[model samples]
Target: MDTRPRRRRWPIVAAGVAAFTASAAIFSQIAFAATLFSDNFEDGDLGGWSKSGGTWAVVSDGSKALNQSNSGSENAREFAGDTGWTNYTVSARVKPTSLPGNGLAGLLARAKSSTTFYRLALVPGGVQLQAVNSGSVTVLGQVSRTVSTGTWYTLSLTVSGSTISGAVDGASVGSGSSSVASSGRIGVQTAYAAASFDDVTVSDTAGPAPTTTGPTPTKSPTPTKSPTPTPTSGGGGSTPTGSWPSSTGSVSVSGTIKVSGSLDGGMKRYCCIGDGSQSESQDPMFELADGATLKNVIIGSPAGDGVHCLGRCTIQNVWWEDVGEDAATFLGTSGGDSYVIGGGARSASDKVFQHNGNGTVHISGFYASDIGKLYRGCGNCTNHYERHVTVDNVLLNKAKYVVGINTNWGDTATLTRVVVQSSSGIHVCAEYTGVAKGSEPKYLGDGMGDGHCNFTSSDITYK
Candidate 1:
C-alpha cells in the first residue's frame, strides 16, 4: 500500500577522499586528465570537498593558498559525488576576494541528484552560466566585463554534444545547447564570495558539433488572420488577433498552439514571431523539437516598449491572467536566452523587466499573483543590458508594491525553492536614479512556515 508521492528527504554529507595519488604530484604536468582541490584554511584533504551547512570557512590563504570564507552572512560551497562524464571538460583558477555584491566563483556541472546542478560562475561582474535543475535556477550565460577582484581568473567548461561551452581567461564567453539531461556530478561554487580555487580539472570531450544550420527558412508572412479563433464549443474564449512578422522577421512553430487570447499591448500576441525591431532581430520565439508550450495565455498591451526573446523558448503550464502593462519582457540587443517554465500571473502594472539589453530571464515554476513591480531596467530605458533572473519554484502571493529580486539593473537574481509571502518581500531601487521608486518590500526568508523554501540573493548563489 504505497500510493507513491512522498519524497523530500535531504541530508547526505560524505566527501572526504582526496588521494588522487597525492594531488597526482601537483597537476601531473597538466596536459589533459586533471584534478586538484585545496583549502589551506587549516586541514588539507578537501579533495572530496564538503562544507555547506552554516559557518563555512577553510580560510588561511595569506601565503600557502586555500580559501573559502563566510564568518556571518550565510555561506555555501558544495561538491557532492561526481556525476561522472558525458563529454566532460571542467577547469578553474578563480580568485574572488572582497566580494559582497559581486561574489561568486564556479564550476558545477551536470550534477543530476544532490538537488541538481550545472553552474559555471566567476563573477566580479562577468562570466556566469548556470543550470540548477529540479531545484530551479537556469541562467545560461553572462559576460558583461567585470572579472578582476583579487586577481587570478582562468575558468573553463566544456560539455560536448549538447553544447555547453565556456571560457574565461582564454576567451570564449558562453555557449548553450541542451537536451536537458546529459550526464551529472561535478562541483565547486562560492557565494558570499571570498574565493581561491586552483588547477582543479575534469576531463572527456569530443562532443559538441551537430548543427549545420540548415532547414529553417519560412520567412513568416502568412498570418493575415487566424490567430486562433474558432473554439466556440469552449465557452469563455474570444480574443484572437494576429499581425507581427515585419521588423527583423522570425516565426517558428512545430506543433502545440492554444491561445485563448489577451495580449494587446505586449504587441501582437505571438505564439511565435520575431523582429521586435532589431536589438538583434527582436521578436524571437523558437521551439523546434519537443519545445514550445503556452496555455491560457494573456500578455495585454505592449506595442513598442517590451517583449523580446531570441531563441530557445519554453513557457509551459501557462496562464498570464491580466497582463496589460508589463507581464513578460526580456530584451537582448546582442545576446540572448529566455525561458519561463510553468507560469501564472495576475496584474502587471509596469515592471517585470523593461529594457533588458544584454538578455537573460529565466523564471522557473513561477507564480506571480499581484506584481506591480519586479524589474531590471526602467531608468528611462536605453540599451540597458546584463540580466540573469532565476526564480525557481516561485510563489509571490499578493505582491502589493514589490521591487527586490534583482532591482536597479546589472541583474543576477537567483531564488531557489522560493516563497515570497509578499506584502512587499524585496525592493531595491538605487542605481539609475531610483528607476521608478517603490520601496518597503524586504523578506529574505526564515519565516519557516513550510512553504518548501530556499534563499539566495545578496545577488544570488546557493549551488
Candidate 2:
C-alpha cells in the first residue's frame, strides 16, 4: 500500500518544432555563451515544462506560444534546467490578453518550488518584485508604470549574488535582494489573468554591461508620510512611532498595540516599496513581521494593501475605511498562523482580505462592505499546503464575490456562519467560474474534501 498521495498527470500534446537556429552566416557583434534553455513554443507543446497551477496549452494557431487562460492561481515552470546556477538571466515575451480586477501575470526565477521564487509581476498599472520563500512573500521592490493591456513586452531578471535586477523592454525598472534560496526553476505565472508567453530564454552567460554616464538617482514617488502609531497604556514594548516610508518599519514585541488614530493615505497606489532607504508614495500602512499582534487600529485611505503580515500574526479589533485595496494582505511562510478576529471594514475600494502563500488563516467577526471579494486565496502560492482558510461569523455586504479558493489545484476552504447580503449571493468558487469561464472548469460540490468547499450556513440573505 503506497500511502503517498498520487499526483494527477496532465495531458501533454505534441507541437511542431521550428527550424530557425542562429545561423553562423550572420556575424554577431556581442559574444554570448551557450544557451541553457530556449523554447519558442514552435514545438506546439509544453514538452519539457511542468505546471504547478492553471491549465496551459501550446497554442499553434496564428503563432506558436505557451498560453495560460485558466484563472485562479496557476504557474507553469520548466524544471529540467540547471537550478544551481549562481548567476543567470531569465527572459520572456509576455502578453496579457485579459486581466481580472487585480490580476497579475509575470515571470518566475530561482523557483525552489511553485511557492518559493523571485517573481517579477506585471500588475494592472505597475510592476512588482517579490521574494517568496516557502510561502512568505517579501516585496523586494515595486514601481508604478503605465502598462497597456494586450501588448507584448519583453521582461528579464538577472540574479547575481544577493542583488536581483529587473528590466522591461530595454529600460531598468527596479531591483531587490534575498538571501534565502539561491537557485531553482524558471517559469511563468498568472493570477486571474489570461496571458501568453513566447521566446522564453534562459542564459547563464553574461551580457556586456551598458555604458553608464553617472550615478543617476532613481526618483522616488511623491512622498506621503503615514501617521504615527500612538502607543496606548497596555503594551510592554515602546510603540514604534514617527513616519516611515513603507511597511519596512520593524516592530518586535510580545503584547498588543493600539493605533488610536486613523492613518490616511492618498489615491495613488504604489506598485512596490523601494528598499526603504527612499521615500514612497504608496505602500502598506504597517509591515508586521513574525509574531506580531495589532489591536484596535484603523487604516484609512490607503492607496495600496493596508497591512502586510509576514509570519504568525494576530490582528484583532481592527477597522479599515476608504482603503484602496485589500484591507489586510497576509503573506506568511514557515507555516505561520494568521488570524483576523473582531474587525469591521467599510468603504473598501477593493477586496477586504487577500490571503496568499502558505498560512493558516482564521477570519471571524469581520463585517466588510462596499468591496469586491471578501476573501481570496493563494494570490501567490507554494507547493506547501497552499492555505488552510477558516471563515466563521463573517458578514459581507454588497461585495462582488463572497469567497474564492484560488489555489493551484484542489484548494481547501472552510466556511461556517458566513452570511452575505449582496446581489450576487454567496459565491463559493468564484475564481473557477468567473476566471476560467467554463473552458477548463472548477466548481464547488459536496463539502470540503478534495476539490470541494466545506460551507455550512443558513443565514445568508440576498435582496
Candidate 3:
C-alpha cells in the first residue's frame, strides 16, 4: 500500500535497569553511566530494529543513514533495543524529506510499544516533547522552532522517572511528565512524513530541565471543510453539498466506540487515534454492532481506520475530513446489508470503502476525492466471502479507480453515474483474480463490463 504512499541497553548507566552489576543499580548512578548502544547505518542493515509501516532503507545522506521514504504513512516506527529500557537518553540526527500538512518526524524513546512512547518530533508545532500512549498523544512540552525540509537536525529524547524531555540541535524542546509510560523501548517515528535518520545513540541519562516556555499557539488544518451532507433523498442517493462542516467541537477518541443501537455525533468532529498506524490491527474510530447506525459525524485528522460496520450498519451523511487506513470497512459474513448513504470522504490514500464482509454494501450519493480506490472488495480475505458493492451517483475526484473487484472470489462492483474528468486517468472498474491469504491478487484487467463489472460505457459521466 505504498499509498505514498530505537536503542540498546548499556551498562554503568545508573538508572532504569532491572538487573545489572553492583554499580548499575537504578537512577542513583546515572552520572557514572556511559554510552550503551549506537548505530550509524554504515553497515546497511536494520539488524536490531523492528519496523511498522513506511518503506525504509539504508541510504547515503552525507554518509550512510537509514531513511524512511513513505511520506504518507501514519505513525511509521522503527524500534530497537530492550523494552525494559527506562531512564535513558536516545539521540539521533533527523532530516525530513517531506512533511505534508500535519506530518511529523523525529526520534523516540521509552516506547512501551509501537503505539506508546516519549518522542521528540519535528512537526507543525515545532519540536515537541510528548507522551504517546496507544496513539493518544499528550504534549508534555513543546518549543516553537523552524523545521525546514532537507535540513539535518540533531534530536534527542530522554525519559526518567515521570519527566520526559526533548531537544533539537542542542536547544531545549521543553519537558513534560508521564507516569503511564515509565519504562519501555527506544525508536524513531514518522507520521505522514518521510525522514532520514543517522548517528543514533543511547546512554543512561535524562534530558535537561524543562524550559519555561509557554504553550505555543497552533492551528489544525481544514482539509475537508466541506461535504455538507444533505439528508438522504432516497436512502442512499443524496448529493454531497460541497459545504464543509464547521465542527461544533472536537473529541479525541482514544478507543473505539461500540455502537449497539444508534449514535448521532450532532455535527461534532471525532478522531486521531488507532492502536497503531496503517496496519490491519488498527482500531477503528467507531465499531458498530449488528444493525447499528452512525450519522452526522466528521472524522478529523489521523482517523484510525475510520468506522467499522461489524455486521450490518448504516453510515449516513458522515464526512471524513482525513481518512486513516481506509475511510470505513464493512466486516462481512453476516450476509446482512450495509449502506453508506450521503457521506463523503477525502484524502484516503487507500480505498475509501473496504468491503470485506459478505452481503452487499450499497453506496449512494457518496463523494470521494484524492483517493486510491473508492470501493474495494477484499481480494484475499481468506474467508472467500462473496463481497459485493453498488456505487451510484458517486462523485470521485482525483481518484485512481472508482472500484476494484476480485472476480475470482465472486466479488461484484456495480458502479453507475460515477462523475470524473475524462483526462483524469482514473479507471472505472478494475478486476482482479483473488488469491489466498498472504498473496497479492493478480490484476485481471480494467472495465471488462462482464457480469462482475456490471456497468455500461455511459454509466460514468466525464464532467
lDDT of 1 at 396: 59
Alpha-carbon runs more than 4 Å astray in model 2: 1-32, 74-80, 206-385, 388-463
**lDDT score, residue 186, model 3?**
77
Task: State the lDDT of candidate 3 residue by residue for 392-442, as single tens digits.
Answer: 887777889888887644456767777884327787889887778889989
lDDT of each: 0.46, 0.59, 0.74
What's the lDDT of the predicted structure labeled candidate 1? 0.46
Ranking by lDDT: 3, 2, 1
Q: What is the lDDT of residue 105 in candidate 2?
A: 84
Ten-residue region with minimum lDDT total, candidate 3: 220-229
> TM-score ranking from best to worst?
3, 2, 1
Each candidate structure's TM-score, on Cα atoms with residue i matched to residue i, is 0.26, 0.45, 0.49
- The pairs that clash in candidate 2 are 15-43, 16-43, 115-382, 142-272
Q: Which lDDT value does model 1 have at 169?
A: 77
